[model samples]
Target: MPLNRTTHRPVSTNALGGLYVLGALLALGVVWFAEHWLKLAPCELCLWERRPWWVLLGIGIVTIVLPKRYARFGVFLGLLCLMTSIGLAVLHAGVEHKFWPSPAPECRAPAFHGGSFKDWMSAMPARPNKPCDSPDYLFGLPVSMTELGGLYAAAVFVVALVGSFRMGRSRR
Candidate 1:
């Protein structure tokens, strides 16, 4: 027997939101794992890349709780958030590749303020300092992690946008 569209619409809509949430969470988990388990530190641009994922996750949560009529809008917002992330990742990757200079001054190491050597050492940030121009490889791949993240964000954006449109049409 074939599945009825009427019966399947809610399930499919909810599934889209759930999948987006899961993807965002997984991306964040990988970043965290790289920082803690692998002992890799994130640069300023790398930290910037995380903001859109958090926004996407919030959008996914809103999509899940919204009324059926508003769910498509939520999904559309997620697509926009993912696109923003892709842009940031691409910029980060470009900085790493030396295509252009980094827009953020924090890409360079922090300068010491006027003080004794011990005072400067004590004032230094605890986090490991990795410059934005340096690339962190993944599994022997030539591309940096930021580049891979941009690819992943692009894929998710396409999926969410297509799914949102399809779900909207199905409701008519």
Candidate 2:
């Protein structure tokens, strides 16, 4: 195979798969660390943001296992997953900024009607105690982690989209 003119190296499906896998793993690891070590619990939106990464990770692994001919399909799937992540991140960021209300009810403070305190507490979901609208900063950074995640996912989505097209053209 000829090397790509700009990169000066042969781009293969395995390489793209490895990049996707590594990127997803690293992102997940960072969130996990924050949640565990830093005691920063994820809200409902935060948990939703993680779904695409999990899917992307699985797609990357499957791509690695399949033959090179099937790699483009995996890349395409990864692109979709990344786009989903980006969209979710954007929504979360928007909620955090108070630009609009969150779609998830958990993001808002629970309304206590005429029920007793114990009844009201029991009615609430056990998980997602943290409201989705709250912004979780990254190590004191001005930007919230959700915004940063959107940016990162957008970058990866562009890279994967370009890489998939290049792979398709190169094969022809």
Candidate 3:
């Protein structure tokens, strides 16, 4: 296989673009399956974590459609999105492990003071917020979904970084 001249990696812009798209799809698919098929409830943090993947998906589609010269920029954008995802996942995992309190207000219990029972009930959200600390497992694995997401995001970030390096080198 032909290797990149500068980075010595065997990846091309097209492959990297496809990786971005596939990675996003796989992550989103797993979460969807866990939620719909496995009947796992996602907390506020979990929902927040999904946003980056959506962005990555859009970036991937654009990267694939754009010319090779412009694909490097898309890869860079994807790296940013992956970084966001990793940060959110780490935050969520910390909440699950009790390493620190969740930053999300929705993760906290609602406080009611001096309100009629009927009024409080009416003011409550239609669906009660899922507790952020509760760990959901897939296939009986010890790792929580949040941790898994972090690992996946980090891996993709590293790969994309290498691929982008190659892209930059090839331009020289």
Ranking by lDDT: 3, 2, 1
- lDDT on C-alpha atoms for all candidate structures: 0.84, 0.86, 0.89
Which prediction has the highest lDDT against the true structure?
A: 3
In model 3, the runs with Cα more than 4 Å from the true position are 1-10
Measure candidate 1: CA RMSD: 4.4
Off by over 4 Å in 2: 1-10
Candidate 3 on 23-52: residue-level lDDT in tens? 999999999999998889899999999999
Q: Cα RMSD (Å) between model 2 and the true structure? A: 3.4
Q: TM-scores across all candidates? A: 0.82, 0.88, 0.90
Task: Between candidates 1 and 3, name the one with more favorable TM-score.
Answer: 3
lDDT of 2 by residue, 1-172 (tens): 9877775344678777887899899889989999999999898899999999999999999888889877778977888899999999999998998899889887777777887888988878777478877898977799999999999999988877777777777765
Candidate 1 lDDT, tens digit per residue, 7-121? Answer: 4343356767887899899899999999999988899899999998888788888888888778778877888888899999989988988999999877776688698999988
RMSD of 3: 3.4
Q: Give the lDDT of residue 35 in candidate 1.
A: 91
Which is the better candidate, 2 or 3, if ranked by lDDT? Answer: 3
Candidate with the larger lDDT of 1 and 3: 3
